[model samples]
Each structure stands twice: as structure tokens, then as C-alpha cells.
Target: MSDLVAEHRTRSSDWRSRPVTWLVGTGFALAVLSLVGVGLLVVRADRAGQPAFAFLQWNLFLAWIPFVLATCLAAVHHRRGPRPLLWALGGAWLLFLPNAPYILTDFIHLGRRDGAPLWFDAALIGTFAATGLILGLASLLIVHHVVEARSGRVVGWVVAVGSLVLSALGVYLGRFPRFNSWDVITDPNGLIAVVLERLADPLGNPFLLRFGLLMSVLLLGCYLVAWVLGRGILGPLNGRVTR
Candidate 1:
């Protein structure tokens, strides 16, 4: 019993000394705040006698999946380098990565309902969107570092940019066709058909182009801001971890 306790304490102490601890702690704190915001929305809905914005809860839950995956991938990569397990985790992470930022498009529901005040709904949605965006960016950064460690700096950045581009398309598909990440596995043919039909007529479906471009630009700007802020704040700690 004493040996087990001592081992647990030693492991905890070791984790605290690592930079990823800070990231994980911050992510957890933000997740709690997001959950609180969702709870408040639920309370408001209860009072209003209608189910308004309940979907936010599920959306926020989906948003966390990628962050969790990225954290797991980071831990695996740290322990085992670029092994097959790491690649499998990476694939799953990328598949769900867009979900984190997909909440931003929820702003379209800003004034669509009446159970809650416009201001309150705006604040609630904004809170979830911001939380989701931060989680997404943080995960991307984690993956970026892993890629950089494996490949060169140039390739790392290329992967990062490519991820953003793909995520933008993902957001579009989710918003328009309402395809879930699982659909890729459960209904690949249907998903592919929708994608092809949408792409086959660019002029007829200008909205797809417009939406994708807007989202890509928005994601890129937000990511750049996040990267700069993260570097400014965690530069020394990050250096220590990477070393």
C-alpha cells in the first residue's frame, strides 16, 4: 500500500513539472466554464418552458473530442515516438478537429429563437464558440509540435495550414449537409456523393466557395493570433518541454 501511494505521488509530481500539465489544466478549466454556460442555457430554457439551444450541449461535447484526442496523441508520441498507435490517434484527431471550431457557425442561430434574450443567447453562443476555438487551436498546436519533432519546421507548418484548410471544408459540410464525423465511417458513400455534387458545380454552388473561403480566412487569422499569444506567454516553458 505504501509503495503504491509513493508511486502515485511521484507520478503526479513528475506530471506537474511538465509543460503539457499547464495546457491540460487550462483546457480543463475552460471546459468547466463551457459546461457552466451550457447549464445556464438549460436553466433558461426550463424557465422559458421550451427547449431552446439544447443542442449547444451536444455541440460543445463534440468539440472536446478533438482536444482530448490531441492530448492522448501527444502523450503517446512523448512515450513512444512516431509509432503506429500515434498515427492512429492522429487520424482520429484530425477527423474530429473541425468540430471544435464548428461551433462558431452557431452564431447563425443568434436571433432565431425567442425563449432567451438576444444578448444572453449571443453571450452563451460566443462563450461556447470561443472555448471551442481555443481548444481546437491548442490541439492544433500540440499536433504541430509533434509533426515538427518528426519532420522539419517547414513540413510542420505545411501540415498546420493544410489542417486548417481541411477543417474549413469540414465546417461547411457540417453546417450545410449536416454530416457528422461518424458519417465518414458509417456512410462514406453518401458523404462522398454530397461532397462531389457540391463540388461538381462551383458556379451554381457559389455559397460553398464563399463559405469555405470565409471560414478558412477566419480560422487562419484566429490560429495566427493564438500561435502568437501562446508563444508570447508559454515560450520558455514550451522550449523546456520540447528540449
Candidate 2:
């Protein structure tokens, strides 16, 4: 027990020493800002007697669920030897991962409003969606780093590609069928059955296939851009940061 505790402390110390900690901190601050921005939008809408955050409140909540989960998992993954715990956290992270990027779909709600100008609504949705996307990228990078450290580069790439594909499908389920991540826990068999049924006839479900494919591409592209920009920003500190 003493040795286990000591090892955990060492791992925690090592995790805190990494450069990526700053990135995580920045992402969290941005997430808080996004939430605050939405809250202001809701207040403004209410003051104007508009619908006032009927759908966006729920969507933003869902987006934050995955961000918080992934952030927790990122911190936990840095510790060694609790393989089962890591697996459980990783599974949960993947399950809710789609919700982060799912905010992009909220753009469909953008339009003229009673009190707010069209640009205001557009900016509001854009900020939330952009923050969600950044959150997704940050979370994904943390998970990828963890996997790469434990596994190898090839396996890490596999996990990345697989996550993109699966997340795309998850987004489809959430957007069209109105399924939530908890459905997997609440209705495991039903969710599995629906997923299997859909997989069995992927061709028949054209919308699902197309949407999933398109979203996957978009996610991959956005991830690459975010990664490059992050690297560029952190490049100056690379000599001081541990690989």
C-alpha cells in the first residue's frame, strides 16, 4: 500500500510537470468563457422576451459533460499501473466524446432573433461551437498522448482514427435520433440493438453514412489544424518541455 501510494504521487508529480498542462488550463478557461457567453445570450434573450436559451442551454450542458470527463481522464491517465481504472475512464471519455463536437450542429439554430442581431446569434453559436471543437481537440490530444506512452505510435494512430469514426456515428445518433450518452447505461440492450441494426445495413441508412463520413473528415481536419497551431505556439518552449 505504501509503494502504491508513493507511485501514484510520483505519477501525479510527473503529470503536473508536463507542458500540456498549460494547454489543458487554457482550454478549461475557454470553456468557462463559452459558458459565460451563452449565459449572457440567455439573459439578453430573456430581457427581450425571446425564447431565451431553450435548446442551447441543454446543448451546452451536453458539450461540457464530455469536456469535463475527458479532462478528468487526462489527469488520471498520467498515473501508472491502474490499468483497469484507466480503461474505465477511457471508455467513458470515448462514450461522451461526441458531445464535444456535437455543438457544431447547433449552428443550424442560428438565425434572426427578437432582441439579438443575426450577427450576435451567429457569434454566439460560433463561439460555443468553436470552444467545443477546441475542447474536443485538447481532450483527444491528451488521450492520444496517454495511449502513445502506454502503447506505440501505430496503436495511437489506430485509436485516433477509430475514435473519429465512432464519434461521427455517435454524433449522428445524438443529432437525428436524439440519443444521449446515458442511453448506453440506461438502455444498453436497446442502444446496442439499434447500433447493430444500423451497422447491418449501412447502405440503406444514407443519411447516417453520409453525415458520419462528413463529420469524421471535418473533425480530422479541425484536429490537425488545432494541433499544428498548438505546436507552433508551444514550439518556443519545446526545449524545456518533456517529450
Candidate 3:
């Protein structure tokens, strides 16, 4: 036990010593911003009519949050060299957990609907399929930027290949995704059991996923869009954050 504890401490110290600690701190800060941003969006969603900004944040999460987090985390971990992409893939799904309640309430329309939508099958397909594309494309850009900044050839390649593979898988499984309302967090007296039953089979597939053919086109288009927006426009404004 003592040996194990000492070994753990050694590893912890090594991690702390890494220059990537700053990046890790930045990532955690971004995660906090995501929560705050999402919370505001939820408030807006609960109002009689949702605002465009609300949908923007919501769609940003749906489209890009997972990928942003994945790229950051993967780049940090890629310090060790190319490896399997399981943790980053798993991170995408785990990231969905905290956002589930908001999704049930806002996206699933549990508050307004007496039961789940009839076209749930199509909805899930569109939701998660689009999700994978957004996330995947965002990951590609973020990882590319990080690699350019860090001068890691292998890390860049791993991120490129692994992100693509896991993204493909994310598109596949995320389609037709199922969930349980699991006791509405927003509605106290909500019909928990009925809500669960209603949302249980609600769909979450990608809208343009179409076995990734459509997704590829859309993803590539978005990549160009992001370059224009982030690197071209915003980069000049942000003190020239090169690479």
C-alpha cells in the first residue's frame, strides 16, 4: 500500500510538472464557462419563446462542445505519444451526461408535451448524427491548432486519425440514441414515470450523418467556415493568436 501510494504521488507530481498544466487549467475553465453558458441558455429556453442566442448556445453544444473538449483533452494527453482514442471517445459520451437534464427539458420538450414525440426515431437520428459531425469537425480544427502550436508531428497524426475513427463511431451509435427523462429536474411534480416512458425511445441521430457521406460534406464546409471565422476574422482581433 505504501509503495502504491508513493507511486501514485510520483505520477501526480509528474503530471503537475507538465507545461500542459496551464492548458489543463484553461480547459477546466472552459468547462466552467460551458456550464454557465448552458445554464443561461436553459433559462432562455424555459421562457415562453426561446431566443436566438439560446438556440445558438444550445446548438453550439450540440455541434461543437464535445469536440472542443476532446481536442483539448486529447492534446494534453497526447503528451505520452499516439495511443488508442478510447478516452476521448468516452469523453464525448460522458460530456453528454451533465447536459442530459437540459436536453430532456428543452430539446425533448418534456415540459410542453403530454408524451414523447411520434417522430422520435427521426429526431434522435438528426440530433446525434449532426452532433458527431459538429464535434468531429471542431476536434479536427482544435487538434490542428494545438499541434501547430506544440510542434508534435505524431500527436497531430494520432489526433487526425483517431478523431476520424471515433467520430465515425460516434455518428453510428449516437444515431437513434435512447434516454430516460429520469425524473425531470425542472418539473417537480412532473409525471416521472410517464415522462421516463415517453422519452425512453426518443431519437438522437445525426441530421446530415447519412452514413457519413452527407456528414463529410457538411463537416468540410464547416471546417472552412470556422477557419474564416476563428483564424481569419477573430485571430487578428485576439492579439494574433497564431497557430
Candidate 1 per-residue lDDT, tens place, 104-207, comes to 99999899988778888889888888888888998898888777766667887898999999999999889989999999999999999998887788778778
Which candidate leads in lDDT? 1
- Give the C-alpha miss distance for residue 140 in model 3, angstroms: 2.4
Q: lDDT of all predictions, in order shown?
A: 0.83, 0.74, 0.44
Task: Sort by TM-score, best first.
Answer: 1, 2, 3
Can you write out model 3's per-residue Cα lDDT over 90-118, one digit (the tens) per residue?
34533342232122223433234322343
Q: Which whole-number lDDT from 0 to 100 does residue 215 have in model 1? A: 90
Best-fitting candidate, measured by TM-score? 1
Regions of candidate 3 where Cα sits further than 4 Å from its true position? 1-138, 146-169, 177-209, 228-243
When 1 and 2 are scored with TM-score, the better candidate is 1
